[model samples]
Target: MEYSEKKALAIKEYFAGGTTSTKLGLKYGFGNASVSRWVAMEKKKKRKFEEYAASIRAVREGMPTDVKALQEELRMARLNISLLEAMIDISDDQHGTDIRKKAGTRRS
Candidate 1:
């Protein structure tokens, strides 16, 4: 049976008042496992909502310093990659080494 919003609210209220899932399910006319599953789903939704709210609060407080740190790290990584590519090019030119690719293959 589809649970109406009112029924769901009543069940939640009953659950909050220390009612067991088995008791609530019997009272609500559903299986105990269904009540337990609904409660578990609600808990997961509540946690996800709290997490999103926290992230929103963090953004509102400031641009989240960790994000700035990560952006800086990414920029540094790109620069390092470019420098490494240049070094590889120079090494290949100077030593005639195929360090940039596997042996017997032209792809780099």
Candidate 2:
């Protein structure tokens, strides 16, 4: 059964008119199952659209969206860098390792 926008609009109109799918299907020449399927599809589309709109609104409000994960990752990176620098300093001082890069020419 090929459904189109026309049939969908008719379903919406019949629904808005306070009629049941059983009656609307009879009037629209489709079975109740078809009408229900069309309504369900429309509902799913509406939910997805609403979610997308909400995300857009969040961004417009300067509320960083989808950044919590990035923030967590950045925080971990900083911690790791700190730990590595501490290890390097401890190794250079206690172990007498000359791995640290020199900043400039040493004066005689």
Worst 10 residues of 1 by lDDT: 6-15
lDDT of 2 by residue, 30-105 (tens): 7888888887777789899999999998787764545776898999999999999999999889989977668995
**Candidate 2 backbone collisions, by pair:** none
Question: lDDT score, residue 103, model 2?
Answer: 94
Clashes of each: 0, 0
- TM-score, prediction 1: 0.51
lDDT of each: 0.81, 0.80
Candidate 1 lDDT for residue 66: 78
